[model samples]
Target: MNKMIALMLAASASALLAAAPAYAQDASYKSLTDKATADYKQAKVACDAHSGNAKKVCVEEAKVARAKAESDAVAQYRNTPRELGKARKDVANAEYDMAKAKCGDRTGTDKTTCMNDAKAAKTAALADANTGARAGTNVAQNPPATMKENCDAMDATAKAACMTRNAASSTKVAVEDSVITTKIKADLVKDNDLKALDVHVETVNGVVMLSGFVPSQAQVKKAADLARGVEGVTDVKNGLKVK
Candidate 1:
């Protein structure tokens, strides 16, 4: 009888152990679902408040949020033997239909173009949804700005490349601004204090490449240092000659 009781207790402990993970999974699923639902509701409300092209864009954004929510719910359901996958696909289809309805009144090339644009937007939205499901939602909304900041923080050549890839307009402005600032600094050096000194500032790929002549090593270092401090200069290539 003692042996029988021991076996029953062991069986109960094993069952509880098995159930623990299932319980944990359920809790996790619930949390994800609640957050996703809240995001979708917020998006819907925002979309409904706009009009015209802005409204269209807002709706597109909301669809992306909804897609993400549905995808998360479906993924959680897949582990529990539910029909949530089918429901998620249905939600995706419905989103497509709504997009089409929103864009239907557009006329001429605008109509066809609008439809194509809507399709592309929906595709991108789905991609974003997938990314959010894996990495979280905030990353999707702020990627460009975050990438630009990271690029700006890099050293010289790499920073130039990063800015080129991530922020073209800002990079262009930075390069031009560096060139102008370099010219100003070069003009400030006392010409009589230096001889046979020529300052050349060339910008390429958003990096300042300084080439020319200076009277002394001090002037050379000064020119390069000034170039480095200019906004948008990824690097300062010092190729100055000291007489």
Candidate 2:
């Protein structure tokens, strides 16, 4: 009975460890978002001096600035090459939007040429983003040496069992945690009221921890609620502080 209990505890611990997800612990997402917003506002204010097509172009430029800033922030927060690729693509689209807006100043064949040039630029940018995405898709690697070391002390049969369990657990945990984190971040960023950059997300097993600062208690609650609503999230520990 004692041996059985020990096995049960070991299995529990393994499950817990296996569910944990890896993430970037040091990225400052909030500060970047804030700076982006401030810069966009300043750019928009500068646009007030212009009129007609110039003002339209200026507004689109401001949008481009905001899009690029947020893209960079998201890429850093995710710390994944695929996400970085997507961010770059988003910037490209924003630039295309601004370019098309600028084309409004011309007429006849000049405007047509301008639009074609904008499309070509966007296409080139997307090609670059695709290359980045392909490069990042191979991020998965073999299980850590520690997992093998832990199994080495066991008898042959036990070692085989341990290795198998560790390998399966690691793969499952990584995939699950990554999906959960991505979904939660997407939800947070989409919410108009929530300052997503202000929050830090980490997952251990199926449990999520939200850390950092928000503007109000309501936002803290909202962030936690949003996290909890995501699939595969077993629980949420809200560590967000009111600023």
Q: Which candidate achieves the best lDDT against the true structure?
A: 2
Which 10 consecutive residues of model 1 have the lowest summed lDDT? Answer: 136-145
My TM-score estimates for the predictions, one after another, are 0.40, 0.46
Residue 230 Cα positional deviation in candidate 1, in Å, after optimal superposition: 34
Tens-place lDDT per residue, model 1, 68-113, is 4554454443322123334334444555555576566668887786
RMSD of each: 22.1, 17.1
Model 1 has an lDDT value of: 0.55
Off by over 4 Å in 2: 1-27, 137-243
What lDDT does the true structure give each of the candidates?
0.55, 0.71
Cα lDDT tens digits for candidate 2, 171-241: 77557766887788789889998844445565545667575445678998999999999998988967554
Compare the candidates by TM-score and give the number of the best one: 2
Residue pairs clashing, model 2: 19-205, 20-205
Clashes of each: 1, 2
